[model samples]
Target: MKSPIFSRSSSPLNSHSSISPPLTPRRTFPETIMEENIDYATTIITKWDLDGPTYRKMSSLFGDDRKEAKRFIEGVTGLRNAMHYYLKINSSSEKLIRAQRLMQVAMKRLEKEFYYILSSNRNVLDAESVSRGSTRSSLSDSLEDEVQGDEIIEDGNSISEADKASLMAMADLKSIADCMIGSGYGKECVRIYDLIRKSIIDESLYNLGVEKINPSQIQKMDWNVLEAKIKSWLQAVKIAVKNLFYGERILCDSVFSSSEKIAESCFAEISRDAAINLFGFPENFAKSKKILSPEKMFRALDLYEAISDLWPDIEMIFSYDSLSAVKCQGVASLVKLGESIRVMLTQFELAIQKDSSKSPSTGGVHPLTRYVMNYLVFLGDYSGVMSDTVADWPLNAQTPLPESYFSSPISGGSAIEDPSSAVTVRLAWLILVLLCKLDGKASLYNDVALSYLFLANNLNYVVSKVQNSNLGLLMGSEWISKHESKVKQYTGNYERMGWIKVIMSLPKNPTAEFSLQEVKEIFSLFNSGFEGTYKKQSGWVIPDRKLREEIKLSLAKKIVPSYRVFYEKHRGKIGREFGVESIVRYAPEDLNNYLSDLFFGTEVSTSTKTWSSYETSSESSLSSHRR
Candidate 1:
């Protein structure tokens, strides 16, 4: 035992152990995490253009090899430079006038094609007895041919004399977007693209000029089913470009070292435009220098900015004192268009990609991330090496690329990753809520479905944005509280005083997103009008028969404000002057506000009548009033 006691000098546990059993193996975590990082190089070629996936696919076809794409881009850059030179020279000379005239003729053909689209889509041109077949005959055999023949008019002879007249009437975007891809004429491409994309919106502007729908008419619109198609179409592209933009930017960052400029410019352009459109047009944007940037190629033609005529006829409707004449309807339409633009923008993006593929280069383009990392270490010395390497970034081609790009991950996906879209969307929701607020009594039956759709989309966006944030970033941390506060204020307004107040608070227990399941879940309820009039009438608190049994309970704290207003207005005429008999029945809840005023506004104290006295009160009152 003494020898055994001396045997454990290095271990204290030897002295403490009474009975030693077999030692259990100690479990430890592995020192190295065996994660096989997959090489995404080939797959990521599509991810490099932050503009979008559609853009990647469109541009990826520029060539099978580097040489073809570079050669194509060189020709494009040359064309752009030439156009700029022509414009500079044209500015002072009659040649400028000549260019304008040439623009007009091109526009006229574009207009004719647009009418053809409208004619094809609907019988709007039924006034002309034009069949779809006849229209196709006049244009091309199929929709593709129709689209191509109408838009791909490449030669100078296609230019005509309509430039002196207003160009707004023409559907020029289809042409401009095509030219951007087909010709590689970037400057003129951007210019005409701006006009053309905006021209699509001009149809809505023109629609506003049509006859107005009264509040009564809107109430009967059956907004739920009425809005189904537009809602679906709107959602189709709303998230597409943004999503593709993100994936592409991520790939670009991963793939090349000089993608910094392309990515940054893409992001800056998207952010600038998203902010402007969401917040309502900046009054001075037209005068700003950014108007000339590549991102605005489509936006330069953004008709939404110029078209205030579409806003609700606020000046005529609301007296400036009580209500702000926010073009309530116009606000909704513009937002809808914003959603629509995102979709149509897919075409514009696709065109850019297709054109970029025509250009070729011998050396491989650097991935975007390495470009950023090196620039960071060198403090921009490495940036000079990137020059003439990355090729035509959609945003900045000519100007000396920014020294150290701002918004390095500039792309659609990155833009969405920012809280910018959510903020813009919520602001749009705010605009709609304000419109609801200003409508007053007339708003009760207004088509609230669209408002709900806008709100739900934004809400979904917030949740989507939040998911993008983790331990590293929180959605609310990115100054999204500003957006929330702004949106909440508007939603609050509608809740306190308007219909949206009720709709949002409708207890999500019932209403849901428009999925197949929700439709199936609510269809029976919908047939019973649960989603329609039932939802509207849910606000009225029917005083129990017991309340009528005792006046005290009837006039309790929860008396509908409408009844209180009605009671107040008639209190003087009925309670004081006419002895509460002449107009009591006339003060129904229909005039809730006025009724609330009548009761609460006056000196009558509320108390419960005895059950026995309830009968006597009505009879005696009638008898007394019979005089």
Candidate 2:
């Protein structure tokens, strides 16, 4: 997925320690104080654990409906304290000791910084926060991120005080969440939460079932018996999951790279639960209302066999609107229902298939079928080329990558060669888009954020100007080559969208069907744009009328009459509206300089004396200079 261009890991774990607020080394406080903090933290965790999923609903009990605001605030404070003690206690080992000292200092600094940040009163969905479910890391700076970071230091009005405060708090909240879920809560804890949640929902589902047909009246049941049955079902679910995902399948190739990777990831980075619905139909579940509803059936059938016998819609995201009627939408929930239904329906398929085969079918290939074809073309050897980092990504199943992740393919590839550059450009665009997206889904840029930094400083335009220059490409190439900074976010985003869509169309979860044109029209940018951009740019210049004539003649057999989509888009009416050719001709020197600047930052400074070559002159300027 495309990371924001300006993502800075606000977490103390960020490598760029100079910019980040320091973490206090968590030394053991007095035992009494440590005990109190632990008790408070445990209490809050217990409350959160018990509240289960309705914590949001219960938010109004506080003066404001800021869900768990007080608890969250207290938790933040207590967590810091507990972390201090935990670090202190674990500092006996050499490795743990070093980590403790670093964390100790970092936590103390963060505590002070956290307080400073919370004083602001605005929502903190700005560019500076939010990435990887949590926010803040040691990535290179983008203008958006740099400006935000600089604002705090410079007392600039890039962000309102309120917004800044919110961001600070969110950073802490996000960091803590990541640490807990990663090291403390763990997958087992998450599953336990899921089990409990499912038990509650199952009870409700049972009640719904009983209203239609009580377990007691089914001729073989009583209340305790039903309760026992439901309990067994819960146990079975846990067992099934343990069986399905525990060993080889756990480590198999998925969307994510590792064993503890996102299960739905392999189906293409969609949520694991979503993958089940997309690819695997609970073999036993059919039209049984207990597992599948008519409405759900309509949605799941969206991805069923198309008019083409083999092809299926490979990429189509089911929207919230599509799932409006589905009671719940998560892998665990879907699995619980689908698993049970599949077991029950296996026996009755013979009867159902007999009746279904008798009906005559009017047919045209479905949009999903086309999508699958498109995906195979797009994926092209990407799997073979995928990074080995998948093994390094620890288990994280609770959250899925956001749907909005987008980047150019050129960018994703560049990221492989050079991660820093990848982190830079992609993270920058991501933060800007995300900030814009979050701000009321507001105008894409606000005066305070994107617009403000743009106006406040000309850096953005400078970056763009350099980026457009021919020499700029040279500088970029060099920068990436030397620093190995990757900037390709494109490939990741395309695959993510493709997988999400494919999974959505499956018969597992009820989601609406969409056409191939609809899918491509919406997401074509991610998959096709980057590579397409390269193809278009590689031989972009017309070279001469001869070349144009030659191309047209060569393609005449298959070419459409129009050149709008192909040649003209890049040519840009060559008169006053300049295009790549213009830059290539008059500014190759400057462009190389620009690329160098982008890649090396200020490290590889260049002077006009070196770049001011005869090669940079227009034809008229060259003639005049010659005279």
Candidate 3:
């Protein structure tokens, strides 16, 4: 598609020498008088004032009369001053009143006069064209020339004079909106936008003609300057929001109460500011008297909740794709905003890590964690647009627009059809990445059981979250199954390490009668293994009940039954004077109870014999004293 602003024209404006005859250069006009008011006015208008040569051409075509040019320039200065005064004061009802009067009266009169002058010169322009025959190069050159910085004339191809007047009015309104925003009158800026949009809808700009501009044709006007100004303001807003929330201050490792509050306040402030200034929502909504009487109060929308509700509107505005006929800067800025959001979220994770390092017990649910998850959830809502923005974009393409990004009808509700699916899946993957990082932190603990316990808790929390939310669908059932397996694996790890000694102490079935010394050795090994394991793990804690039970039951299944069988068989064979209860230390039921207390700080005996010497002692004691 052709560039929206500077598409290659097939008319004389861009035709080659073979297609259009070249013409001799005409004498240029004398330098224009520098009208101070005009110069200042142009700043607000943000468009070019006609240059000396172009003004001379226009002057010549209108019988050397500069009356219309002078009037239009003076009117622009008056309009600019009025807008400036309105934006400068806090309560400028008087200024707005005057500005509105001038806009409707003085501005409309100037537009009609300017149209008259242009209309009067049409016949002279046509006569000149006929005399020049096919030598159209002069006309093309004039159209190509930049008058003031950004202004241009489009040769014989121009919109209706009424359209031009309306466009110029919009340009002035845009400047006022900018000044209002800069002066911290965000609400006033919104008001100005509302006013301008209302005027457009009412077709009030066409005071000179009864014909109104088609809403569809509003883009024909040069809105690039106005859009650029508004977009730059929004970009600054986004930057301020980023710095306020995720800057070095929030990333600091301080543990003060105020320090934590700083993060919370930053989030609230940014969310509010972005909603009002960047996304253009009102500060507060008015409620009906009846509703207010019943409740006595009303709650404002939550920033995150409001974002979720309004994201489709936001996406529609920011994800605009340029076409051959329309161009918007919204897409570029939106991509930049998304990138910043992603970076800020990453920094939040880093802060959590830093905090956890200082206090390992800082593993509870945190506001930062909640906010990150909320953002990820919000991203899921628009992941379709995001996925297309990143992947469907062509490499090094000349045009700024990606083809049919959100508008494409070829989607099948898959990742390709719904880019949001990919983004949702990516967020799920990010959660896993976070779990892995937390797992690495867990491994730093000295107690192997405690480390495994920490890992199990984190993985379980993540899987539960995915299961309860749309994240599960995006990640698919398989993803949940995979993480569930990880949770089980961590549980197994804790049980295996915590019960290894007890597991190895189980005695085999006795084939012959054993001596009293043999019974004493076997019981001593059980005493040492169970006592040592219990002592080491007594202070360890697994806060998750379900996981703790799973670990306990698993250890029981491995060692308890074996110990019970070995004890029953050997009870009669040993013939020891000491009771079997004293030798065995733990009955099968007792072992089960001990296993249940594995993670609840269970008590351990003070004295524990070493199992390593049990083998040597069995033989030596058997030789010295037999039953």
Residue-level lDDT of model 1, residues 1-627, one tens digit each, is 376545666465765655677997863332111000011211232233234355434433221232333333333333333334456644564433443333333333233333333334332222122222222223221123222322323232332223201111112222222334333333343333234323433333233222223334433555343233223322322232232223223322221113344333333332223222322322222223333322332231233332333223222322122222233323444444344333333333332232211100111111111111121222112122112111121232222424121122223564345443333222223222322222331223244432332232233233333334321122233334444454454334423333333233222443223443333333333223322433443332212222112322222222334334433433343244432342243333433333232211111212232312222343343222111
Models 1 onward score TM values of 0.16, 0.19, 0.41
lDDT, each prediction:
0.29, 0.30, 0.43
Candidate 2 regions exceeding 4 Å error are 1-74, 81-86, 89-179, 196-627
What TM-score does model 1 achieve against the real structure? 0.16
Q: Which ten-residue region of model 1 has the weakest summed lDDT?
A: 358-367
Which candidate number would show the highest TM-score if scored against the true structure?
3
Better of 1 and 3 by lDDT: 3
Give per-residue CA lDDT, model 2, range 384-445, as digits (tens). 21112111222222224442222223444554565333323332232233222222211222
Candidate ordering by lDDT (highest first): 3, 2, 1
Best by lDDT: 3
RMSD of every candidate to native, in Å, equals 39.2, 36.5, 27.9
